[model samples]
Target: MGFHTFDIDRADALEDESRYRHLSAEELLAVLRPHPEMTVADLGSGTGFYTDDVAPHVGHLYAVDVQEAMHDIYREKGFPETVETVVADVASLPFDDGALDAAFSTMTYHEFAGEASLAELSRVLRPGGRFVVVDWTATGAGTAGPPTDERYSVGEAASALENAGFSVDRAESRTETFLCVASV
Candidate 1:
């Protein structure tokens, strides 16, 4: 339902640029369709890595992470003025109903992937708002990212979203990761 490993010790690994090979910022922005006036949230935002990549495009961006220590590292690195850190779980976001214009999680989905979390996402995102997920897929060979068993396939992600009351727009797989986009 929520992330169990709130380890800040691996914070530096989150900053690795090589991760873009799995999901690039350009691809994320394209799928997210972010607007200048949009209020977005980076779900499971670790050290503001991908959050920083998205900040300049959005009017307001919430870096939501379960770990405050990760937010501390994000603050120390100095994020954009538009980026605000919110320490919270994916299953229990602090925002009101229909509060987010869009939300996304970068490599952190498996940690909080479940019906409750998906339902919470569906509850917070406004009608027609986008919710994109880019994470390691279970079908991939055991290489980088989390173990294959812990990951969700694109189909699983799409099915979970559909069950949670969101309409899945696109669900595709890469060599090691999957991209699933859903709309509220």
Candidate 2:
């Protein structure tokens, strides 16, 4: 199981630009490599922060979150034409099998890391589709994001994806975060 869910009251913090210092939009876009015709999902999307960054690049973007209140907050922020809000958990998405061309999660992996969640990700993504994850690392200093004990190291995440039948192409650990790119 993962850590506790984020507090809905702190949803505003998710929109802070300073968060880019940990995971920038440019860096996420570079790894995501979204094409105009591809369909993508922003898993655990809160307030559509990073989701907005990827929306313009994809044909369809699903801002998926377990909390409908978060979706309400995103709606107030103005959703893009291509972005659709889906109230669903990562372990049990409403998408069809192989419906998505790709999927990405920003700083929410620790909250949803488990066998069921990873398997569902593999099921929804098309063959050769990418799954990008950027989250606080267990090896990091306890200064930002979740506590170290509640996080996963890059190696643990990579191994979990591999065990879920994904081919990990990139796994890098930075000062406070880890980025992992895998393909179904």
Candidate 3:
């Protein structure tokens, strides 16, 4: 099976499981404190994990996801009124240029519908706005987390963002994750 279909089963299972959900949200906040008041868009906000935690810190949060089922959870969980849940694809988000102060995706970039996702991410931020990407490392035995063919290391993701018109500020490996902070 192709990469797109490779994790369909796991993604479906994730919709009902909250195991990694809270931990991911906490990890996101750890890196985003400096820009706490900035408007943020939690792209591919599966289960509103980061959405709910981030809403309290950011000026506003656009909790966007392509899945209605996920959005329904956001609503049911009674996320702060500050969150605006929108149903949309990550690669083709329906946001406007310079409209966001920052954007974040946790363990979601590998699932990009295609290259258009990177372009869309670069297009929506203001010139100096930050883009924080937190995803599983694409190497080491922990590579077991994502399909080998579809993952990217921090270096690879940094290069892709640079190609998409971002000025990479940081690209480094964490204990078990890869992270990058870039400016559009």
Q: Which has the greatest lDDT?
A: 2
TM-score of 2: 0.98
Pairwise TM-score winner, candidates 1 and 3: 1
Q: Which ten residues in a row have the lowest lDDT in candidate 3?
A: 1-10
Question: What RMSD, rounded to one decimal, does every model reach?
Answer: 1.4, 0.8, 3.4
- lDDT, each prediction: 0.89, 0.94, 0.72
Ranking by TM-score: 2, 1, 3
After superposition, candidate 1 runs with Cα above 4 Å error: 1-3
Tens digits of per-residue lDDT for model 1, 42-107: 998999889999999999999998888999899899999999999888899999999999999998
Candidate 2 positional error at 122, Å: 0.3
**Better candidate by lDDT, 2 or 3:** 2
> Per-residue lDDT for 15-59 in model 2, tens only?
999999988889999999999999999999999999999999999
**Superposed Cα deviation of residue 76, candidate 2 (Å):** 0.7
| Per-residue C-alpha lDDT of model 3 across residues 1-184, encoded as one tens digit per residue | 1334223334444444363542465666776653556878987786676677788887789988777777775577678877888887767777887888888877777767246777888788877888888776667456345665667788888888888888998888765568888888
Number of clashes in every candidate structure? 0, 0, 1
